[model samples]
Target chain A: MLAKIHITLKKDVLDPQGKVIANSLSNLGFEGIQSVRQGKYIEIMLDGNDKNTATNKLNEMCEKLLANLVIEDYSVEID
Target chain B: MLAKIHITLKKDVLDPQGKVIANSLSNLGFEGIQSVRQGKYIEIMLDGNDKNTATNKLNEMCEKLLANLVIEDYSVEID
Candidate 1:
């Protein structure tokens, strides 16, 4: 199974790196870019065929190491 | 318009950060993990309603500043 995970900052959390990207884009003459928010995308290949098991393991991985629970949220997709 | 971009390293490029994550996951007892690859996900809010225009601008953005064309590949989706 392959698990795709997206770990993103919560709505209330500030993202300085994203802010810098937005500013840089504006300076580059790309107009009307209101905001930019960045996150982490991870793809994990697992040796299992069961989707359920992979999902459970992925969730556990997120909670344990992939995501900072207090400031970020994660979503997982199994294939 | 909202543009979602995924910037990933090419298959040939070595990703040290991902290797570290895989090692950490193994140390944490997650088994049967074949590999872990990490990328960047970015969302941009634009003031235009036209998807075509947004897509064009996004491609330009990616080429000009968003991605390092030498070692990375980028995909842009407009919604």
Candidate 2:
């Protein structure tokens, strides 16, 4: 099984890198781009016995090592 | 409408960042971790009249600005 996780800074947190990218976009005349938030896209392949087990283990992995829950938010898609 | 674009280095391209991440994962005891490839996830909010138009424009944006075709490959998800 493969799980894809996206981790991003919470909205209230400062994102200097995102700001820089947004500015660059505006300069390139991408007028409708109001904002940009950079994030991590991680794909993990698991050897779980089943989907249920894989989901549980991947969630645990996220909380333990993948995401900084205090200042970041994350969501996962399993495939 | 919002379109999410995922851009990643081509399989043949060298990814130092991904190598570093894979090494970190191994050190962290992620036993089955074979490799890691870092990528970009960009969400663009468009004001197009319809989905078809938005996709067309977004494709153009990817080719023109969002992706580096020489070393990167990209896919889009519309929502």
Candidate 3:
């Protein structure tokens, strides 16, 4: 099975890197760009017998390493 | 308008960070994790009259700032 994890910063958090990119785009004349938020997508291949097992494993992965839960939020989809 | 940009490392690229995460997940007893590939998602808010103009602007953003085309591949979806 394969699981796709998406991790993103919380809405209120300041995304300095994304801000820099947005400014650079504006400077390059790509007008009307108002904002940017950068996030992470991770694809993990796993072996699980069922969705419950996969969900449990993925939750552990997200909490321990896949994301920094303090400043980021994550969601996972398994196939 | 909002454009979502996804940037990912090329297939042959070595993702040490993702490997580390994968290993850590295995260590945490999340069984059967065989591999992990990481990527980036960027949301850009722009003002454009139509898809063509938005696409043109987004392409410029990707080339000049949104992504490092040398090591990454990118795609964009607008809404």
Candidate 4:
């Protein structure tokens, strides 16, 4: 099984890296970009076959180490 | 319009960050028993209405700034 996780900053938290990217894009002549937010995409291969188990493990992983719960949110998908 | 992009290292490239995460997960008692790969997810809010134009601009942005073409691959989704 494979678990795909996406971790993104909470809406209230400021993202300086994303701001830099937006500014760089504008400098590169790309216009009309109102805002940019960056996050993490993680792919984990598990040696299990059950989707339920994978999902549980993925959520645990996010809570324990993958995401900074105070400042970020994470979503998991199992396949 | 909104553009969501996922940038990932090519399969052949080594990802030290991901390795560290995997090791940490293992040490934390999470048994993955496989591999983990990490990537970037970016969301861009555009002040335009046309999806076609947004897609084009997004591709250009990825090629020019968002991704390192030599070792990373990126996919863009316009919404």
Candidate 5:
């Protein structure tokens, strides 16, 4: 099985990295670009397991290590 | 318009970050997890534009700045 997780900062959180990228894009003449927010996409391949078990395990991993729950949100998909 | 991009490393490359992460997961008892790969998920919100224009701009951004094209592959979606 494989797990794909997406972690993104909360809407209210300030993203300096995104701001810098947006500014760079404008400077590079990529017109019309506005706001940019960056995040993580992680793919994990694992031993065989049922869907529910994989989901539960991956969620625990997210809460404990993958995501900073205070500022970021994470979603998991098992395949 | 908003653009969401997912950038990931090519298969033949070494992924030390992913390896470390997988080890950490095992150490933390997140059982069954085998291999891991890490990537970036970026979301950019921009001014209104036709789909073609948005796509062209975003693809340019990816090729030029958003991705290390020699080692990473990027996919973009406009919303």
Candidate 6:
């Protein structure tokens, strides 16, 4: 099984990196860009075909290492 | 209006960052993790409801600054 994870900063968090990106975009002539928030996209290939197991394991990975739970949230897609 | 962009490495590219990340996952006891690839997810809020304009501008950003066209491909979603 393969899983894709999207991790984004919490709404309340101050995204300094995002702000920088937004400013850079504006300076680079992308004037239509109002705001920019950057995040992580991780693709993982797991061992077997058990959907439940893969989901649980990936969730564990997200919680343990892939994300900072206090400031970020992650969602998973499996195939 | 908002746009989401996903940037990923081309298959022929050597992903040393991904290799290191995969090894780190294994070392951290994520045994089921077979392969790990990392990418960027960018969320951009645009000025108006013109999806076509936003799409073109985002594509320009991707090609010019957000992604290395030599090794990365980017896709955009607008709303």
DockQ of 1: 0.93
Model 1 Cα displacement at A55 (Å)? 0.6
**TM-score for chain A as predicted in candidate 4:** 0.96
Q: What TM-score does chain A reach in every model?
A: 0.96, 0.89, 0.90, 0.96, 0.94, 0.92
Model 2 spans with C-alpha error above 4 angstroms: none
**DockQ score, prediction 5:** 0.88
Residue-level error in angstroms, candidate 1, position A76: 0.6
Cα RMSD of all models vs. native, in order, equals 0.8, 2.3, 1.8, 0.9, 1.1, 1.4
Off by over 4 Å in 4: none
What order do you get sorting by lDDT, best first?
A: 1, 4, 5, 6, 3, 2
- Where does the lowest 10-residue lDDT sum fall in candidate 3 chain A? A22-31
- How do all the candidates rank in terms of TM-score, highest first? 1, 4, 5, 6, 3, 2
Instruction: Report the lDDT of model 4 for residue B16.
Output: 95
In candidate 5, what are the lDDT values of residues A6-55, reduced to their tens digit? 99999999999999999999889888776999999999997876888888
User: Could you tell me how far off, in angstroms, the CA of residue B41 lies in candidate 1 after the best superposition?
Assistant: 0.7
Tens digits of per-residue lDDT, candidate 2, B1-79, equal 7778888889899889877766776677666655667788877665655888767766776787778999999888788
Interface RMSD of each: 0.7, 2.3, 1.4, 1.0, 0.9, 1.2
What 10-residue stretch in candidate 1 chain A is worst by lDDT? A48-57
Estimate, for each residue in A16-76, the C-alpha lDDT of model 2 and write its tens digit.
Answer: 8877766776777666665666777777766655777767766766787777999988887
| Deviating ranges (above 4 Å) for candidate 3 | none
Write one digit per residue (lDDT tens) for candidate 3, span B17-62.
8898778777887778788889998888877669888987787778
For B1-79, candidate 4 gives per-residue lDDT tens digits of 8789999999999999999999999998988549999999999999969898888889999999999999999999987
DockQ-based class of model 3: medium
Docking tier of model 1: it is: high
Candidate 2, A59: how far from true, in Å? 2.4
Give the winner by DockQ: 3 or 6.
Answer: 6
lDDT of each: 0.94, 0.75, 0.84, 0.93, 0.91, 0.88
| 2 versus 3: better DockQ goes to | 3
**Candidate whose lDDT is highest:** 1
TM-score of chain B of each: 0.95, 0.92, 0.90, 0.94, 0.93, 0.89
> What lDDT is reached at residue B31 by model 2?
62
- Candidates 1 onward: DockQ, in order: 0.93, 0.49, 0.78, 0.88, 0.88, 0.82
